[model samples]
Target: MNKENLFDTEDILSEGGVRDLFEEVEVGEGEKIVKQGDAGTDLFIVDSGQCVVIDDKGAGRIIDSLDRGDVFGEMAFLGGELRSATVRSNTPCKLLKLSREPFVRFLRKQAVPGTKFLIFLERFMVERLRKADSLRVLISGDQDLSGKRGLQQLRADIRARNTKPLLSADDPILSEICHWIYARNDQVLFREGERTTDLFIIRKGEVVVVDEGAGGFLLGTFGANDAVGEKCFLDGKPRSDTAKVRGNAEILMFTRDTLVELLERDSSMAIGLSLGLGSLLARRLSMANRTLRLLTYEELREKAEVSRLLSEMRKSLRIKTLH
Candidate 1:
C-alpha cells in the first residue's frame, strides 16, 4: 500500500495536529510496534510502510496497509484498555508515533465544549473498538461467513450472559413511556441545550454521542447497545451534548412525564434507573478525564480559549487542586 494513498497528507497534518506530537521511527521488516496485552500509551500513524495485525490465534492478517495518513492503536489510548492485537511492520518502514498525552491534548483543543467533548471522546473510543472487532473478523476470513448457525450461537451467548440489565426487558412501566423515537443514519437525536424530554435506551443499532464542535475537532462516535439522554431527564437540565444515529437505530424512550408517573407508582424502577444513570455518568466522566489528561498543552490551550466557560472551569479545577 502506498503511504500517501492511505492518508491525505496535507489534510491530516492540518487537522490531526500531529506534526509536533509525532516522532519518526524506523523499523525493520517484522518489527513489532505494539504487543498484545501491553498497556497502550501511544498511537501510530503510518508514514512510509505497511503493517500486519496479529491475533492470539497466531494468525497474521493485513487488516489495513498504510503508507501514510492512517492511524492505529487508538482503542487502547482512548479506553485505557490493553492492546488487543500486535502490530508489526510488514517491511522496512518509517512511522510517526504520537504519545497519548499529546494526542489527547489535541482532541481537547478541538473547538468542542467540555461536556460534549467528553461524550465525543467516549464515542470515538467505542468506534475504534468496533473497528478492531471488524478487522479481527475480516482477517480471520470470516467476513463472508455470517451464517445462521453463528448468529444463533451469538444469540445463545447473549442469553446466557450474566450481565446486569440497565433496564429490565419485561418492566411493565416501559409500556407507558411515550416520546418513543427511531433514528436513521445522520438523524439528529438531540442537541446540546435542547429541553430535557425523555430517557432513551438502545433497543438496536448504534447512536453516536457528539459534542457541539465550535470550530475545532470531531470528538468521536458511539454505537449500539448504549443509552443516552438520561442525564437531562434525571436532572431536568438541558441536554449537554448531541446524540445522532450512527446507522439505522431504534431507541426505547420514556418521556419526562412518564418517568414521573413511574416514580410516583413503581418507585423501584426510578431507583434502578437512577443507579444505572449514575454508573453511566461515572464511566463518561472517567473517560473524559483520561482524554483531558492525555491531551497536549497546546490542545488544552486551544480548548480553553474556545469557550469562556471551559476556560473558567479549567482554571477553577486547577486552582482547587492546588489549594
Candidate 2:
C-alpha cells in the first residue's frame, strides 16, 4: 500500500521480463531525477538507495521518500501530464525507468504479468489517493468537494468515442458480472462504511458519490461508462463514500466474487478488465493530487488573512487606548 517495499523487484520485474523492459539510470546524490511541471513520459522505480519527492514551490518541501522498490513518476504511465512534484536523488541511487510506449507493447505481448503489474500499480495509487485526500481535509478542515466539472472530464476522457474505457465492454465476460438494471431516482446504491464489493458502471443518467466522512460533501460525479466504487472493489475494502442515483439511471452492478471467478475462468478477459480499472484509478488519483495542491495554497492564503486580522486588532486597540 505504501510506496516503499511495494514490489519484489526480481519476482515482478524479472518473471514477466519486466526487468528487461526498463532502462536503468544511475544518479549522484542531490541530482534531480524528475523536474516539476515538466512533461512526464516515464515511470521510475527505485532500484537502489533513495530519492526524495519534493514540492517545487519556493523552498522545496519533501512530500515523500522513495526507498528500494518504490515507484515514482507514475503519472507518466497513468497517461501524460506535467510532473506534479520533483524527485531527486537523496543519495547515490539507481532507478529503473519505464516509458509509456514500450510498456504498452509489453502489456500487449504478455498477459498475466501485465495484469499482475497493473493490479500492483492500482493498489499503490489507491493508497496515495487516500493519503492525499486525508491531507487535503487536514489542511482545509473540510473537503472542498467542488470539482464536479474536473472529475467529469476525467470520466469523459476514459469514455471518448475513439477511446476504449478502462471498464470492460458489454460482452459475454462482462454479462457474467452483471446486467443493466434501471435504478430509480433518489436510489441509494451504497453507503459509506457499508460492506459492499459491487462495482457500478453507469449506462445512462448520473450517479454522485458523497463523502459521508466529510458530512456528505460531493466527492465525485460519474456518468455513462464511468466506473464507481472501484477502489473498494479492487482492494476488497469497505466503501469509503456513499453513491446515490442523481436521476432515474440505468447501471451495471457487478460483485467482486464474480469478477474473481472471471479471473479464474479466463485469464485474458480478467487481465483486460483489471487493466482498464487500473487506468481509471490512475485518473482519479491524478485529480486527487492536483486538488490537494490547490488546497495547500488555499490554506496558506487563509493563514495570511488571519495574520492581517490580528494586526488590525492590535492597531485598533492601541488607537482606542489613546482616545
Candidate 3:
C-alpha cells in the first residue's frame, strides 16, 4: 500500500498532535472503505480518488467526490454514532486512516486554540447538515404541516402560553425588528459567532440546533419549536451553536438594538424568554443524549451482523461478477 500524505501542519491531526497515527492505504476500484451501519472507529482522509456515498434507500449519492485533502468518517469518531451512510471507491484511491484512540488522545491534549478550531469544524458540519435538510425538503414532495398553520395562530399560541405579553403592534421594538423569510431549502439561520445582526424565532417550519465543537466532532441535531440566536442578543456573544431551516421556514427577526430595548423596558419579557430558552436547552440536551445511546447501540448490533454475513458469503462464493 502506498502511504499517501495524510496531514500537513495545517490539518486537524497536526493541530491535535496526533499526526503520526494516520497511515495511507491504497484501494482498488469498487473497494469498500466503510460499510453502512458499521461502528466507525476510524476516520479516513482521502489523498486521492473518488468516493461515492450511498444512503439507505439504495440511492447512491455522491456527496462530494473527495480528492486530495478531504476528510470523511469524523462524525462516527466524534460522537460514537453509527455510520449513517456507506463509502465506496469509484476509482483507484489512496487514503489515510486515523484510529479512534490516538484521535481522541490528540483532542484531549490539544491546546485551547486547537480545541476551538475543532469546534468551528463541528459547527461547519452542522451547517452542512442544515443545508442537506433544506435540500431534502426541496426535492421531496411532502406537505409541511407547520406551513399550513397561519402566522396569527402561531402568534396566538405563543401569547397564550406566556404569562408576559407578546409583542404588540404598538410596541416600539416591533418597528426595529426585521423579519427574514426563508423558503424551503434556504439557509435561514447560522450558528453562534457568525457575525449577523439578527435574532431568529421560528415563525413557521422547524429549525435545527447544532453544537459547536471546537476542533472536535459535531455534537448532534436539534429539531423544531426551538429558539436560536438569543445568546447573541443577550450578551453579544458569538452564536453558541448553529440554527438552520428544517423545512420551508419563516423566522421572526429582531436586530440587537431592538432586542436590547425590549429587554430593558419589559424585564418580564426577558425573564420569560430566558425561561423558555432554558427549557429548550434542557430538552435539547436530553434528546442528544438519548439519540447518542440509541444510535451507538444500533450501530454496534448492525456492524456485528454485517461482518458475520460478509465473512460467510466470502467463504461460500467462488463466482466472480461478469461486469
State the lDDT of candidate 3 residue by residue for 1-323, as single tens digits.
01011111134443434556678899999988887778866777777776766654336654435556656665565445466567888899988787767644554444332333333334334333333323222222222333433433533433344332223334454545545565575374776467663656665566656544433223333223445665444334456566666667766676645434544556444334433443333233223323322222333324554334322311210001110
**Ranking of candidates on TM-score, top first:** 2, 3, 1
Q: Estimate the lDDT of model 2.
A: 0.66
Write the number of the candidate with greater TM-score, choosing between 2 and 3: 2
Residue 204 in candidate 1 has what lDDT? Answer: 71
Residue runs of model 3 more than 4 Å from their true location after superposition: 1-16, 60-63, 113-117, 133-142, 146-323
Question: What's model 2's TM-score?
Answer: 0.75
lDDT of 1 by residue, 70-154 (tens): 5566555544556656788888988777676665555445311211222322333333322322222222232233332343443
Tens digits of per-residue lDDT, candidate 2, 45-121, equal 77788788787973797756777777776655765657877888999998778887887777767755665566666
lDDT, candidate 3, at 277 = 44
> Lowest summed lDDT over 10 consecutive residues: which window, candidate 3?
314-323
Best by lDDT: 2
- Top candidate on TM-score is 2
| Winner on lDDT (1 vs 3) | 1
TM-score, per-candidate, Cα-based: 0.42, 0.75, 0.43
How many clashes does each candidate structure show, in the order listed?
11, 0, 15
User: What is the Cα-based lDDT of residue 177 in candidate 3?
Assistant: 53
What's the true lDDT of residue 1 in model 3? 8
